[model samples]
Each structure stands twice: as structure tokens, then as C-alpha cells.
Target: MPTVDFTLRWPDGRQQRCTSPSTVIHEHFVDGQEMPVPELVARMRVAMHAASERVRARYGFACTGAAEQLEQIEAVAARYGGDAGPVTVVAVGKPAVPEVPRAS
Candidate 1:
């Protein structure tokens, strides 16, 4: 399984480093994009669940890091109530490695 570590700039301009046990995050987000807090949290929910499922499928147990990441996102989002603004996607520490083609 591939692991991904991403950085997000919170509403208060503080950057947080987050991790996922799977590469599902690339499907949900990208670097240099800004998303509303609610949207970001929502995406995290979906992505983390998928990531956990991946971990469960491969290792027979869900990934604790996924749960922790979601909690961090939720906590940051909590600081901003209704109409919480956007958060910037700073960087991805590791991206999905492209598959190498096999010779036929």
C-alpha cells in the first residue's frame, strides 16, 4: 500500500501536516488548490474512509492514521463556524508512483 503525506494551510494561516495510509488522497485533492473548510472536511471524510477500507482490504485492519487525519481536519474546521473559509493545499510529500508498463 502507498502512503501519502499532505500539507494544508488552515484558515489562520497555520500549516498542518497530515498523512493517509493509502493513495486515495490524490483522488480527492491536489497541491495548490483551495477548498472551503466544510468541503475540505467532507473530502477528508470520504478519502479517509476509502483509505481505511484499502488498509483493511490489504492488512485486515483499518488505518489509524486515516482516523487521526480526519480528526485533525475536523478540529481545524471547528475553529471556523458556519461559512468557514477555504484552506490551501500546500504540498504532497509523496505522490502516487506511475506504474511501469510491462513488455508484451
Candidate 2:
């Protein structure tokens, strides 16, 4: 298990810090990619509903984290614990993908 600290800047010159039970945060290189942690947090309701369907489809268990996903992730992280290092940091301003050349 790994924990990542997400620093978010607010519009009114405020900053917020939150720790997430995520191994890594990957920015979208390809189109239509989903960043699960952000998505889960932003759209907890929908994501939880989908997650319920996900569990049901997988092990025939109908469990959704409509309001408990965050706590669950945190609890799991605590149970397994995590290493402090081995975390890769990507700059927010970096390019998502490499440029390609056309063949003549």
C-alpha cells in the first residue's frame, strides 16, 4: 500500500493538503482516461454506484462506497501500511505525451 499527498491550490489563494491511499497519480496521456482517485472523490455518488456494480459483477457482491469509499481506502492503507519512499513525483506542468513524426 502507498499513500500520496495531494496538494490542491484554491482560487482564493488558499491551499489544501489531503493524503490519499494511492500508489501513484498518473495524468492523462491518452484521451478518455479516468483518474480513479479524483473521480472517486469528485463524484463519490456516481463512482460508488458504479463500484457497487463493479463488485457485484466480479464476486457477486453488491457493495458500494456511496459515502464510505474514502474511509475504506484509508482503512485499507492503514491495515497494510506503506513505505515512505519509492514514490515517483511528476511535475504538473510536464507534457503528458511525446510528440510523434509522420512517415514520408
Candidate 3:
């Protein structure tokens, strides 16, 4: 299954990757006008933190698949800060191969 990815940026022109790739309600609708850069960055930070916290709370400090995902997410967050536009959610792992039919 595919998971959500998030990229956030701070006002100091810093970026960070979410510690986990999960969906978080960080989107906001604005009228016909440019969104304040600071506000937008703040929203992303909140969203990333919320999602990260939820994941950690659900799964303690364990080495599960989700845990690995979280580490990746954090790396992303750290790199992009909290101002990155919509974080791209990419599918991890190799593609599956179709099975061939065999005669009985």
C-alpha cells in the first residue's frame, strides 16, 4: 500500500522531512490571494509534528516497518524544513511481478 509524504519549511528558509509518511490535515483554503509565507510554513510544521506524534504514540520505540518509514520521514523534514510545498508521497519497495499460469 502507498503512504503519504510531507515536506515542511521554516521561516528561516530551513526545511525538514516528516519523520513518518502519513496523511495530515495541513491544507488550507485561501481566497484569491497569495498565502502568507510565514503562516503557510507554520501550518506545515504543525501538520508534520501532529502526524509524527500520532505515529509515535501508536507505536512505541520499536523497529517495525512503520518505524523505518518514520526515520525516512524525519530525514525529509530535516532537509526541507517545514515550508516545502505538498510533500510527495512515493511508493516504496520494488514493483510486484505478475504470476504466470501453469498447466496442471
Candidate 4:
């Protein structure tokens, strides 16, 4: 499984660095795109769940880190009122690739 980091710029001008245990995050976010708070929360919810499910399928266990990240995102999002502006997707970090051993 690949791990990816995504940066978000909140409407308040604060930047949040988030992580996922799976690359499913790419399907949910695009760099430099502005997303509404509620839409972001909903998209992240689905992405995190999908990411955790991928980890569980491969490692036999769900990814706690992804869940934690989602919790933090939701908490921050809740701080912004319904009338708040959209959040920007600052950047999406490249996925980390594991080294593979070549046959000798």
C-alpha cells in the first residue's frame, strides 16, 4: 500500500497536513482546487473509509492513522460555520513507494 500526504488551506488561512494509508485520496482531492466545507468533509469521509478499507484488505487491519486524520479534519471543519467559504487543496504529496527486492 502507498501512503500519501495532502495539504489543505482552510478558509481561515491555516494550512493542514493530512495523511492517508492508501492512494484513494487522489480520487477525492485535486491540487489547487477549492472545495466547500461540507463537501470537503463528505468527500474526506468517503476517502478515508476507502483508504482504511484498502489497508484492512492488505494488512488484515484497518488504518488507525487515516481515521485519526479524518477526525482532525472534521474537528477543524466544524469550527467553520455553515456560511464559511471553501477550503483550498494546496498540494497532494506524491505517494511513497516501497522498495521491491529483485530476484537474485
Candidate 5:
């Protein structure tokens, strides 16, 4: 049950922090091996996109800024240390992807 915490900064100077269960991480690293920074960042981006989709579907609002905001994504922490109170920081930034209409 590993979790990834991240921060997303909007164009309007507003920031949103979110944590989500990392299925990709869990499925790939069930043996508790330390994940590479690049892989972690990629998985995080996928998670963020999924999250954004969920929010848009639930609220019926377009997340036009989400793609741009993802450029400012920061992987704050990953809690994979089991019972050791250890946290790993994999700070990475991803390039902005093309914006797509959320309303379907």
C-alpha cells in the first residue's frame, strides 16, 4: 500500500497537494526494492492524469490547467519504508503535455 505525495502548482499561483495509492509502484516493486527516480516520476505522472480525469468526471468541470500544472509536478515523498519511519524523496519535474478537453 505505498503512497505518493505530490504538489501541483497552477498558473494562478495556487498550489494543490495530493496523495494517491501507487498501484504501478506496488505492482512493479512488490519486493520493496527502491524504485529508480525516472520510473517513479513516470508512474506519478500517470497517477496524476488518472486523478485529474476522476475529478473532472465527478465534478463536470474542465481541467484545462491540469496539463500545464503538471509541468510543475514535484514528487514530495514516497512512503515505502515499512515500519522504519523512513521516507524517500524523489524530486523530479515533467514536461507539460498537450492539453485535452476534459469535457466529453
Candidate 6:
């Protein structure tokens, strides 16, 4: 199964490395739909939260104030060696300036 790796930095400058199976990563896009980097990051946050919840449920242990301590979450890497693979989604950026047609 594919996995999404990320790091979460706490308010105290502590960092926690976490990974979640791609199955838990939500479908943030539809057919031909696009999003921005910030939105993508938001989706990642949701996935991380879900992963944390799973851990809490299965292992019955979780970091205190984990939810509130989330200073930043960054997607580090992804592995797709098995049945799961990368997710294809368009991350839109600022619109390009229109080119002025020069006189011949």
C-alpha cells in the first residue's frame, strides 16, 4: 500500500514524524478539478488527523494537545511500490500575464 509521509511541528519547536496509508487520504479533487498548494496542505492536515485518530483507537495512546500543537504540517515523501501509487491532481498557480501582440 502507498504511504504519505509528513512532519508536524509543535508550538514548542518539537517535531513529530508521521505517516499514513494512502487509503486514508481523502479525495480532494474531482474530474478535472484543481486546487492550490494551501488547499492541498489543508487536505494533508485532515489526513494526518485521521491517522492520529486511528493510532489512538488502535494503540490507545496519543500525544497530549496534539491537535492544538500543530504548528505546521508538511508532506515529505510518498512511496508507491505496491498496488497504491501517486495521486494525480492539478495544483493551480497564479495566472500568467497575457502576451501583447507586437506589430510586425
**Model 1 reaches what TM-score against the true structure?**
0.84
How well is each residue in 12-35 modelled by candidate 2, as lDDT tens digits?
A: 323334333222232211222323
List of clashing residue pairs for candidate 2: none
For all candidates, the clash counts are 0, 0, 20, 0, 0, 0
RMSD of each: 5.3, 13.4, 8.7, 2.7, 13.5, 18.5
What lDDT score goes with residue 2 in model 3?
24
Q: What value of lDDT does candidate 1 attain over all alpha carbons?
A: 0.86
Of the candidates shown, which would achieve the greatest TM-score relative to the real structure? 4
Candidate 4 lDDT over 1-104, as tens digits, reads 88999999999999999888888999988899998899899989999999999999998999999899999999999999866998999998899888889999
Q: Which one is best on lDDT? A: 4
lDDT of each: 0.86, 0.36, 0.42, 0.92, 0.42, 0.42
Identify the runs in model 1 with alpha carbons over 4 angstroms from their true place: 95-104
TM for candidate 6 is: 0.37
In lDDT terms, how accurate is model 3?
0.42
Query: Which of 3 and 6 is ahead in TM-score?
Result: 6
Higher-ranked by lDDT: 1 or 4: 4
- What lDDT tens digits, residue by residue, belong to model 3 across residues 67-103? 5554544454455533444443222222234467999
**Superposition TM-score, candidate 4 onto the true structure:** 0.90
lDDT-best of 2 and 4: 4
Model 2 poorest ten-residue lDDT run: 84-93
What's the true lDDT of residue 20 in model 5?
Answer: 40
- Global CA lDDT computed for model 4: 0.92
